[model samples]
Target: MGLSSPTEIVATDKVEVAFKNLDAAILVGSMPRREGMERKDLLKANMAIFETQGTALEKYAKKAVKVLVVGNPANTNCLIAMKSAPSIPKENFSCLTRLDHNRARSQVAMRCNVPATHVKNVIIWGDHLSKQYPDVHHCKVNVSGGEVACFDAVKDEAWLKGDFITNKSWKIVEGLPIDDFSKAKMEATATELIDERDTAMEFLAKK
Candidate 1:
């Protein structure tokens, strides 16, 4: 037994035309956040996009379909999508915060001089924006014998709360090669990160 053939590729800006029988939907489209723009500034601009997508997903996608919103101002965008898709279960919709999660993990690993894989439970709290908190207070990392608290390994609270957590997710995207700053490249990068995080989650679920 092999898996079935691929589904049809519907390329359309119209959400009604594209969403149909989807088992999982990853929303990576939204208006880009410009310099000096706050997350709330994007709320009105991106709300319509998520509303249309949400409505389409509600009507067309499988009832159990999982939705991961990767758009800018993701937390609020996800809230709009969820509200728009009232027919779908609330738990099925989530904002993609894994990029922040991975950033925290990598920073911890680098500080501890261990591979990123050795880090775990670097919790990301609040929104997916700059104000979000990446708390490693209860996180653990692999050691010679077993695992130990990440905070214990790196006691520099000022660095963790200030530079480590705040510098990565949004800034890294802004620092992408100027030529590669198009919508396509940014969407592709977000999609790749979502895929990687999903794979890791699936692996952990099985374990």
Candidate 2:
């Protein structure tokens, strides 16, 4: 290995060792599912894992550590980890939204027949879960004809407002809206990491 490499990989299977003295904790890997495991069982199983990880972070990691949970049911896992680490500031804990963030942009880009880069101001509102919403009310598409509203370009509420996963039972979930407009836009759209796209799979398959 080059001595000047910016980062080094110190792979380990020990959770205690991994959660300690870190600048940032990204809990992305999930425990492999067992046969006949129900959905709730799976959630509980991961919850236990994150709970332990969170406790360790509190006890040993820097008080300023930032955490991002990206495992399955990331929102719940995010909640479990945040609640577990009381000493750690609440704002420091978050779930991965890049997947969904890019998705909302892609959908807008496709609908407008432009590159994904042309889509802007799209926000993923609500908990980063299946029921999480992709809000485009404020989204803008940079078409040749200057900028156009996403709704005007797509013109299909059915395509834009599609079914997503997870229960919307909690008063709080991923992507909380900051205002009445955002709140309504959040309510209007509905979603999940569950990007099964071949490119996403390829990235996950990499070391």
- Return the top candidate by lDDT: 1
> What TM-score, over all chains together, does every model reach?
0.71, 0.70
**Candidate 1 C-alpha lDDT tens digits along 42-121:** 55567768777888888988889889899866766777778778889998887877778888899898898989999986
Relative to the true structure, candidate 1 reaches a TM of 0.71
lDDT accuracy of residue 73 in candidate 1: 60
Cα shift from native, residue 21, model 1 (Å): 2.0
lDDT of each: 0.69, 0.67
Q: Model 2 over residues 1-207: C-alpha lDDT tens digits? A: 111124766666665666667887788866655798865566666767877788888887889998888785666677777777899999888876677878778767776789999888876665444457777777888889589888787778666766322212112345644667556555544222333222233332341
Q: Residue 1 lDDT in model 2?
A: 10
lDDT of 1: 0.69
Q: Which residue ranges in model 2 land beyond 4 Å of their true spot? A: 1-5, 31-37, 127-130, 162-207
